[model samples]
Target: MNKKSCLNCGHTISDEFCPHCGQKSDTARITVHSLIKNDILGSIWHVEAKFLHTLKNIVFRPGKTGMDYIAGKRIRYNNFISLLLVLFGFNVLSYHYYEKFAPAQPLTDDVIYVKDFFSKYSKIILFVIIPMLAINAYSLFRRIKLNIAEHFIIGTVSLLGILILFLLSDIVSLIGLWKPVEKIFNIIDKIIFGLSILFPAITYWTAFKNSYSKPGLLWRVSVLYVLMGIETLIITAVLYEIF
Candidate 1:
């Protein structure tokens, strides 16, 4: 019998995968089921794996992870922009469902407007804010000597750490409990908030220490905290005016 030829480039091959074009020798005919399983389901699984791996690194080794990605070691990590978009999408959907089903007080017109505005413009806001924070980092850590783009990567990862903390807080809030459970949830909420702030600060500090030869960890962290506070104030003012 004649051996199968590569479907992709018509190269004659004997092994499972074609050496010339890398097409599988036993490539199956296209069908609805094949498309759904191979294309759709496979893509979803791949994305999920990458997302989970990236999240783990960002949570546990944020400084090293960002540095690795910037240095072009990114096969295992999800694309930074794609990760941010996915997180933002989750935020929007979770907030929408929470408002619809949760037993929360009716939102005031201003509050509702603010929520809607942020929901619609969250990506744009982040694009603007992240670069600004990157610039702030560059100015504050001039001794580190990282370029603007490198600092942007650090900013992106730091923000992702904060977003993950926010999601955890949201998840905790979803727990419906009686008096004792409610008290426990409240305590958890406070703890999550504290960690949200503390963790990101640590992420930046460690990233800086690893990226450059730095000594004054406390001084650098203090300056970063001050920059964050200033940025938060500016953002609050902008939102106040818009709403």
Candidate 2:
């Protein structure tokens, strides 16, 4: 048993926490040794637990994670900004891989391949992602009441899933599975491509149940469909220009 004192009023306390002043009775006189060891260790442990939990939840179940954060069950996860930074970095890298190596055209034997790849794919990635993310943001803004960052994370995770699917296809293509199942995967890919546009919309629906007074789901779906169509047109134009 450790004897402690309240920092305020100089009252002796039996436990680690002070009942009189409501401060930690274990707080010792500020010293270089204790400051570096005890304070830093405690803070680091608290932060580490939250960060790991957040990463785990985000990776395994993104929709639920967004719902949890929006419902004020935070402190079990990392804050939005930290997750965004990490996600953005990985997203950039993933973008490079998808645009470079996974397309119909191989990167080698053509200097123009890199430039053309970016020219064609960049706009699709941008326009589609932006509007979808916008819908996601507004949905959460109206419904579960999370900040912009949270909805963006939901969108990002969904897009990341699509990207992963594409990469998996690319790998299978290289491993001879593409030849055997090329036709089948192509059909599947087309379906996935269409559904990818609806990811953020679904995420919006799941995260925000009935917290907001707004238009019906049909209205929201219709609006998102129109935005997706516009994005599809923009991407088509960009591809045409590049090719």
Which of the numbered candidates is closest to the native, going by highest lDDT?
Answer: 1
Candidate 2 lDDT score relative to the true structure = 0.61
**Model 1 C-alpha lDDT versus the unseen true structure:** 0.79
Worst lDDT window (10 residues) for model 2? 169-178
lDDT of 1 by residue, 42-144 (tens): 8899888888999999989998898889889999998887788788777667666666677778789988987777776666666666787688778877877
Model 2, 68-117: lDDT tens digits are: 76667876776665555555555556556655655465456466765676
Pairs that clash in candidate 2: none
Error of 2 at 130 (Å): 4.8
Each model's Cα RMSD: 4.6, 7.7
Instruction: Please report how far candidate 1 places residue 136 from its true position, in Å.
Output: 1.2
